[model samples]
Target: MSRRIRVPFVLLLLVVAAVAPVGGAAATGSSDAGTVDVAGTADLDGTADADVTPDTAAGIATNHGGTIVRTTTFSLTPGEPGSVDATMRFDLPDGVPELTVGPFPDGVTVVDEGGFDREGDRYVRRDHGRAALTLRFDLPSEQLSTADVGIDTGDWAYVRVPYVPTEWSYYGDAPAFRGDAAVDGEGAVQGEWAYLGATETTTRSAGDLTVRYVRAAGDPDAPSPDAVFAGWNWLATRLGSGGRDRVTVFALPTPDAMEWRRSPGLASDEDGAAYVFSRAPATGTEPAWFHEFVHLLQGPEPSEGMEWYPEASATYYARLAALNLGASEYGTFREASTVEEPRNVRFTRRSSWRSPTDYRQGALALGAIDATVGAASDGDRRLADAHRRLRDDDRLTYDSFRDAAVAAGNGSAGAEADRVVDAPARHEFVDDGLAYADHAPDRDLDGDGLDLATEREHGTNPFLADTDGDGLDDPAELDRGSDPLAATRDADGNDDGEGSADEPDPKTVDSDGDGLSDVRERELGTDRKRADTDHDGLADGEEVEGVTDPLDPDTDGDDLGDGEERESGTDPLAEDTDGDGLPDGHEVHVGTDPADPDTDGDGVPDGEQHREESESDGEDVPTWSPRGVGEMVGDLVEDALELPRMVADVVRLLT
Candidate 1:
């Protein structure tokens, strides 16, 4: 219950501080997908290639050895309050590539183009030498500065319009460059969040994911990039995402609060970019930036049924990430997950969504599924496991979600998932710590100092004390750097049984058959391998149960231990066995029966005699003297015999 930050956590904080943010550069690059997706709640076609390493600069073409498959140049001009002017140029050396453009959400006009004819929804550039394209963005439909694509302030332009890099046919055979595409980045910026102005950017990396923050030159009051990076690192690591090369987070700072809506931000998973206003969320509980940042990790193929998934996951993961970082409490998370919407409206109608019910309730279902699977597995898996499955599947459904849960946990877990999916908290319980203590096996049944959840998390058996048969319990194995799941070798790769020779028997919790387990023995500083640690007639188990000192043979500091006083019975925890005003230990020391009040039975109790002797050294207090009392009894017996003889003599004389 005493919570102190562990050494590893302290070291992680230090690491986060060590990788400080630096002033960097920002560039422009457009993500080429079949369809255009905005940051609010839309989706693009392609999922990011996690393996592809970007140039570390924001939107530079991905580096795959060296090859030239496609080249694009993007230039942006800061225009009106909510729009920007952009120009895109591409070098078409070999053949004419598909130049997809236009059909934007109104307010976008094709200002000019060198050699292109307008097709139905796209522009057809017939020439192959060089293509020049320009467009004016007046995103009147978007809220002040919320859109990720075309956001223009009075002085700076921050946008990631797919139209910017008009052609992305080369990004793959890799997303920005195709086969042997030795792409050249001249004065162009890189990454999804492009800042068009004479302003420097800042880049920070946590794990493998790097975030480039684009700001107008010398904009102070930005949150320390490291502060946010650490949270992302914790969440991403838990989700099994290592380093994800680099992503862009364009932090647009508003001097006047009225300039942009509070906490306005958006992210593109395809482009790995998030453009958010530098302001806290309305309520601190929901962090808008974290929510936007989490969007970079997820991309759902737009299907009709689970349309609410991306938003739900983002919302839940943002809260979860905060919870794990200690920024929020578990109650908040659980409450947020609890469904308040109508059961039929939310659960029955999959296609239709009602805000809190569909998104928040869906999150709750995910939370419940995670808890069930994690508890069933003893903590080896989480919702992220199922999430990865859902993310990979072409179509998302309750059945697929159920299958993923079952695969991650077990059949029962999947059933729990379905039960929760249908209605919140119906059949199974939910706990982030995986507290399935009431389950059949019972948590910590083996009593090896680890709970069932911890054992399952470590791949150890919940029922078995020694999972690896390594003569050490799982916890002891871990302490000695031995693998809890492997027994063939020790921590140092010593296979000759040398490491386990001195350890207690891991085969049983009570190695020495004492009532206390080995772990408990160690805690009490008792010898776990010895049943009688104190070497008294009483076993250590009995001593502990009786609340006597296990380290001392005489628990009450009495000279006579229970073994010596067993013939007549004695209290090991009590000083006076007979309660005759003398300690049992003193009676034994003074040559008297400790279990009895009288040793000689001369009408003087032995304890009283000892007390009297101690008071007068046997020279005074005759009433308390044992020898004097014995002589007096002998004389009384002699007088009785003489009286009987005299009575017989008197009767003879009368006759």
Candidate 2:
């Protein structure tokens, strides 16, 4: 299979050769006289022609050739996609001209070839051929390129991209993005910021957003003067609700400065007290301002028993939005998997796994929940739909959100949630093996009196029927082309009774759908559902994940996906192979020499013997590192001492 998309958007190759300056080579035809027509004539037809002028108001125009010019610029807008529109005008100088435009680039789509709308000053040229050769075209939004824009004269032409961004427009309003703040008049009003809860605390509204900044009323250093104004701009941007939602930021500079000094009674921080202000902004590290603004819109965490789903859902939304907008570096949310966990010393005492694992798994569970619900609703009740229902229709409690999701999926308010039943089992893998056992809920799958729940209690794996009493699960056998009920057979058709089937075991499924199997994912130090093991938010399974061939790294020969090695700071091929603090290539870059442990000036390497020499006088021996090695050595020494031949030699020497 080809690794890259067959219809690649861009292609560039280097050729070692000398060529004459453009237009110096030939002039087989003139603009006034007839010329052969080809697709791309904009960038490479002539020497600097006279200034052609644009008849219309939208694009720039040059006068000499009288050719109308247009350009395209890509933006960080979603849903509106991307597109290019241009109208070319060539004023034929009373000459019979057979003008040809040729050699269009790959993937350059022509949406409309003729005139579209005719407005007052700049309207469509219905019949440009009669006056001049005017060609109007619309480029595909998803794929934009100049490869198609080549120059073609009657007999000769040149190659270069000529389209420029003279006038750009989107189908719908563009949403706010990171750079939106940089736009003029988009910043805070009145050089000074309003302080929350301080004397300057006030309510203001702009565009569909309401802004409120509250500092502690009694505190002297309640709110900074600048934060309040920035907050207003943030609110306005979010409420605009077009391309990307903006937010009003709330900044608490110190631990004691927040309005709410105490942790309120709530389930998770995602669903914690939203109405109250915090001494510090909520979790998230980059661009410090946006994270807190999202929390402000979160309002207060839903009252106990009320719906708190929005808190977590909104946080998820902000995180995804930030990623899409390029506001935060990739992998910013890797460690936020378990949302509601508290920050106590004991909370960190779980088995030796990292925090990002939990966050990724937890987030994936939420995504799966959304998917399950969306599937049930035939696409009507989406994740956003569920959120709306929770706040508007239901009372907004844990039970309420759960019921809404279940109802949306089953198309009934009281329909039994068989899917929900599997969640507890699934949670065990994600939540560090801490969950209830599997319990198939009572659900009528077949019209017969028997239920799936009853079958689970008595039947074997549903996909695999393994009735013959073989140890392998039927699904496992079918995966390996062996009969599940029959004696286990290896690839050679031998009844080996060893190793499970060639297929992976199903128990260790990934929580995220990133494609890394759970067991291998864990062994390889990665999220099972996510191929990108580093929680950098990219998938290693996809060629895009910084691994060229997610399946076969050796195939690319680069030893890394151009993306993975360039971005995530991990070796694309090896995992901790060098035993350096950094991954292999990184160590190589820092000159620490990945293969050598003692790259430093120090004499000792990093293993047990070196460690022993470096420890303090009273330090205990590192038993965990040396136990097995020491015991095996002691046994060998004792055996050597007891050798009868050696003992006899010693006795003779003494006599």
Candidate 3:
């Protein structure tokens, strides 16, 4: 029902709101008095007093020259059976500012509300709207909001404060989304991110960089926050700098209901913060955690044509970071280079970019530019420096990238950049201070099954190694026809098996389990989402297992599907299993055994048994001519007279 996700993650709608300031400056430490206590505050009745000194920790906290606001708190409680009771509280310091709200997500409606009227798709706020307005919305497990990651499974609730549309809640001259979003009992929401139970927290740090990991307690098979922190550490070290001193990682267990292909994970690059949706383990998108970390160090969206740059850098550097951390191999990296896009596709036309289809293209091109810049500076300058320069550049474009490269002392990179920005052409790419060498193209350096020849075919770096801590190496995976990149899943749905994925089909881990990816099905002219490409009563996996053509309804051209032929005791390849004149399909249609020559038990073969009737083996009887019928009748009468005469002669002889 949903489209396949080419890139590993979805860069969700980046919230662009006008500056609705709630607090003045940043503060350190926590104050219990103002700690956003929404669940149990019988003293304050229903309203959260805004005049009280803002809880600098949860509401609006200032730190490291940045602002973290939590002026808007959305409290969620377990509801009746498969439902969740949710309430939104906005701390409007200047009273309820002129605002219009409503038309909440499906399955969410307010009861006993009298001040608002519906107009088209929105609820018009009336004059009598109170300061402590409590809009009770029911979030059922069966139905979910469009942009919100709110879930209620009758047992626990994971709620990511829904990003309401600007028009849906038009706050005229009022600070609508002024402060940060926090759960009542869960404390401050990270990047308006996941909140489950009470938001238990932990920390992992390297040097000056610290990653705060959060998740619900007792979540099943939650992803290891330590592993994600390790990924961030590697990327930070490789880049020689971390974007910010501290960031948050909400590690929610991957919900069985959550579809990774539709929406995998998200990151707020401005805050150096991202969340790992796989607190529970998953596959399809290999190294999703690391990729999110890379995004933390990136800047906002660039201008047109260069819009692809942010994604390209993230995709490219993330894989490389995984390799640096011993998570991936050179063969895996090289294989991505081999991925081909349309010839007309170029980095300069990034405005027309699509996920994953163009990501690999830009990645390879960016790699070439990085190599060029690295070579020009004789290892003194690298793309990392240029990247740091661009992180703060408000206006990001190709020219700015060139200027950044020049300032980094790789002036020669502009020429190579020209080649990549336009079209991908052959260019000298330096890796580790030397041009990529294919002295032994057939050599499998790491014995991971992939050879140097395959690596260099993409015209990019062949220097790669599987560093990810999985037992199966890249060479072995490729040699065995298993997925060489991304997390591999075993038959038990665990993440430690050799994969046969078609680039991690976005729908599910081999949704059809047909060993083919969804996109590959499209390219092969098969049903993109159906496991049975030809719908011959056989699954694509079954077809593969039985050594039949999954793409053909009738592999043997017998007008019977391979599955049907098997059921009908006929040979799919022979057109007929038995040595009969009738085809298997025709014999079945005529109710005769295709395996038997004489299906009617006559002295003649089934095919020749009805020879006088018709030339075809159809369900029809031959019609006798009128003269032939009369001749038959006369012979029958003469035989009857002779029988009586013979009987009388026999009786006289016996007497």
Best-fitting candidate, scored by TM-score: 3
Question: Lowest summed lDDT over 10 consecutive residues: which window, candidate 2?
Answer: 1-10
Runs off by more than 4 Å, candidate 3: 1-71, 79-82, 94-97, 103-107, 112-130, 136-149, 165-177, 186-188, 198-200, 206-209, 237-245, 261-263, 270-273, 279-286, 340-342, 423-655
Provide TM-scores for the models: 0.49, 0.25, 0.50
Q: State the lDDT of candidate 1 residue by residue for 1-655, as single tens digits.
A: 0000101100000112121122111121223333333421112233333332223346443322222133223344434566566555555533223344445545666778667777765676644456656666664323344433455554555554443224322221222333110112212144433556555566776545666766556666456666567667755555433224677666666546344554466666655666666655423445666777767766344344455566767777777667555465445655655554334433433423445554566666666666657655656676777766666665567677678778888875666654555433322114323331223334565568887556644546554567656566778777755455545443455542355444334333665677886557756755555687655677777878876777666677677765555544778778887777778866665556667676665667666665556433333223334655676886587567657655875674333
Q: Considering summed lDDT, which 10 consecutive residues are worst modelled in model 1?
A: 1-10
Ranking by TM-score: 3, 1, 2
Preferred candidate (lDDT higher): 1 or 2: 1
Question: What's the lDDT for residue 497 in model 2?
Answer: 41
Relative to the true structure, candidate 1 reaches a TM of 0.49
lDDT of 3 by residue, 1-655 (tens): 0111111111111222333244332111111121111111111111222222323346643221111122335555554434444444433223232334445556455543344555665554433233222444445554333344455655455554433322111111212233344556654455444464655677877435677777667666556666666666756655534446777766655556666544455665543455556532322224666666666666534665686676677777776655544466555555545554334355665323456644566776777677666555544566766777876666578888878776765555775576667654432222321122323567654444556566433221334445233455555545554444435565555544444332322334343456666445534544333577555778876776676788677788766778888797777787766766767776766567877876655556666654544434453323334556786886577567657755875674333
Q: What's the C-alpha lDDT at position 33 in model 3? A: 20
Best by lDDT: 1
lDDT per residue as tens, model 2, 418-476: 22222221321122100111122353322224343443332222222342245554444
Question: Which residue runs of candidate 2 sit more than 4 Å off their true CA positions?
Answer: 1-208, 214-311, 338-364, 371-381, 397-423, 426-655
